[model samples]
Target: MNFSSDAAILYWSGSNINLNFKGSEISAILKDSDTANYYNVIIDDSIVSKIQLNTSKQTYLLASGLSYKKHKLQLFKRTEWDKGTTSFYGFETNEKTKTLPKSKSKKKKIEFYGDSITCGYGNEVQNGKDSGTGHFENNYLTYAALTARHFDSQYSCIAKSGIGIMVSWFPKIMPEVYDLINPNDPNSKWDFKKYTPDVVVINLLQNDSWIVNLPKNEEFIKKFGNQKPTEDFIIKSYENFVKSIRAKYPNTYIICALGNMDITKEGSKWPSYVSKAVVNLNDNKIYTHFFMYKNTPGHPKVNEQAAMADSLIAFINEKIKW
Candidate 1:
């Protein structure tokens, strides 16, 4: 079965489409652009693939070798519009397929902001040494998404692989791009009224600490420009960023989160900066949480991500009571 029309376009982050069919194989017709985008391929209720859309118009095989029976498929865009946008031309199945009714909106909503950790970079790597990009990343299985699903809540993940609050691996910081519909383009602004989350989680500072503390990060330093890049500067920048978010969502519960990576000795003081920012803001609605650092060579795997989500779920339950 193949279906295509101009009315099948979905244009937003975390947008999803559902298909109900009885077939052994199915493929999605996607029209993509240069800036890589990702989609979650869920068979039944389990995610089986994190397909990357990096080409022009093409037909990508989603799943195959399944038993011929009635099954449900979920296609979700994991990356934001900043990376690029793709169109779901439709799905091709062995048997006739029909679109399923849209799921009802959840009562609770969450917004996660961070870097690769929150993006689930390298989460699928089994060799522990594989490190490039794409393929291994799966935002659908990320701790943030998992936690949202655990609570049966709707979620929006606004994250890039190497972004930070003060210093990113490149030039763009979260403050500069947080409100942008397209993080890659400064001109693209996202209206605050679009979607407000009940809880806003900030898991940042990892890349900032790593890049800013370097003896000579010429790239970041050059981008840092005239501002004196110091520990105080980092702390102040973080505070200002949080203040901006608080201003936007006055009633939203803000969580200052860090870790699941190094945070001891010189690095240990970083999380404190986030805490001090929340305290200085004098907001009772804001809180801080940290994940214990477990020595992992690469990004957290599926099991580790699950544990992270469990911790977050417990905290959210205690804090927001949702």
Candidate 2:
């Protein structure tokens, strides 16, 4: 992927991802196998980078504003399956800032996994707060994109809105919507061997609690072969999701981010019941570490997104040596 403008600062987020440049432009290359995927790149606050691919090895280039300052990068894997890997590679134009110290070996990769919040669902200006008019208007300025850009000048995003860890609230929707909406169909199957991220961040839960007219625990088990996604179910489902990712990316770092929404709070205005099931899942050893709620409103606003980017940058610095 490449930025449209040379950036004084840059930010990106994705896994099994890579980057290179030609002249004043930067290029981000997606090595993942999926024909479809999403990537977000942010430069300062004015430029938002969003990309959707229907072909393999998607590449993007940004023009102008090339700088040497430290930037943030946040990469997300929107689909539960088809999780691509990402890495950073490029030349250092400025000597003022310390670069990664050139190495011939390949760099590690990272990924962010989550639902609408991580996908920046309602973050953009929309009709009503709940109407969902901004569905196609991708917010490249979202926290995930900002965080990735801060970490490295190269990154990608694969997150989607309204997604769940086990089963999506949007019935009939598949996990690979980040790539192709019908990626599993015989006409559009996606391959996952191409891209791989060293780190994976999983953020889910809000939508899992959105099921309406949920059945009683016993009834749910009889119908769906499991509890009705109560707190325990949520934890178990998340645990399983982690296990699956681990199976695919054995050495990858996993970070589970608790959402910003207060769905678990008591007597909240939202009509849905909050699922406190996975609150304890935050401490599971399967995760490299977890970040608790920052008490920000519904999807993060611009300022809130910036703060999120800062926190993620700090987390990356502390955890990953790169």
Candidate 3:
């Protein structure tokens, strides 16, 4: 996507900022048939920005001179369909300067890894909340994106709806484990190198608990090709997932989040549980953080997303000390 604006530049000297969206597609689902649809971008509760596809590429222009210690950008797609795919990228500059600075501290990357809530699903209301079945607002107001904007950090999101730590509603899929099922092509294996997350935040398990449907008291084993994720199995799988991440980005920070979709009510407690487990395994090397549900009906509301960003910023403040 290409973004440019003739308006005055906006600037911020803060360390944390967030850019959120509602219609970002990480996994390639079938494209929705709606071609006339466009996405909306909102900054800091006002200043609406519109994104439309120009030929094969999507583009947008900003109004300029917008500044904030923490800025929020949201994107929602206006369409009559269930699902579509797109990615969002943004840049900032000072009003007096034509370009942004190229300092090391100015370049930080955060990656969000999770399921539907992270994907910003069901965030839009259409026809009094009953008319639009799968319609999403495609707003950047999601917690992950908003948190990034709050930190003024660069970001990438790798999430899908109905995915879980052990199983998923989508076929041939497993959560967080390496080389499991391939949603793109069931017969093919996934390559992790294509997209590596810097700071990984996982929020899976809602779908796992829902689909398993076993007695709440019964212990289920995660069945992968030949392996089943028993409590022990899951713990080990999480370790392996973290190991893979460390192998890829040895200096990366892994933050595992719980309770976004209430997977605790179902059966998946690994995100919360694994936070403790990984801490025990790596001690001070791996920093773990947990977030409780923000009390929204199905997912987090806008205020909840802002709160998540605040928590993250607080954590970074205590650690980075700059």
Best by lDDT: 1
Name model 1 segments beyond 4 Å from true: 1-15, 19-27, 34-38, 48-54, 61-72, 78-85, 90-95, 223-228, 264-267
Better of 1 and 3 by TM-score: 1
The whole-model lDDT of each prediction reads 0.76, 0.47, 0.50
lDDT of 3 at 13: 9
lDDT: worst 10-residue window of model 1: 1-10
Compare the candidates by TM-score and give the number of the best one: 1
- TM-score of predicted model 1? 0.84
- How does residue 109 of candidate 3 score in lDDT? 70
Task: Give the distance in Å from residue 137's predicted Cα in candidate 3 to where it truly belongs.
Answer: 3.5
Worst 10 residues of 2 by lDDT: 7-16
1-322: candidate 3 lDDT, tens digit per residue: 1112522111110112234322221111112223334455455556365544332432344434454334445344432112432333334334432332333443667776666666566555432231223334343656777777677766655566666656676443434323422234334444556545456665555666565554232223344543344666666656665676567666667765665556544454656567655865674546666666554466555555567667776876676432
Residue 123 miss distance in model 3 (angstroms): 2.3
Give the local distance difference test score of model 2. 0.47
TM per candidate comes to: 0.84, 0.55, 0.61
Counted clashes in each candidate structure:
0, 65, 30
Between candidates 1 and 2, which one is better according to lDDT? 1
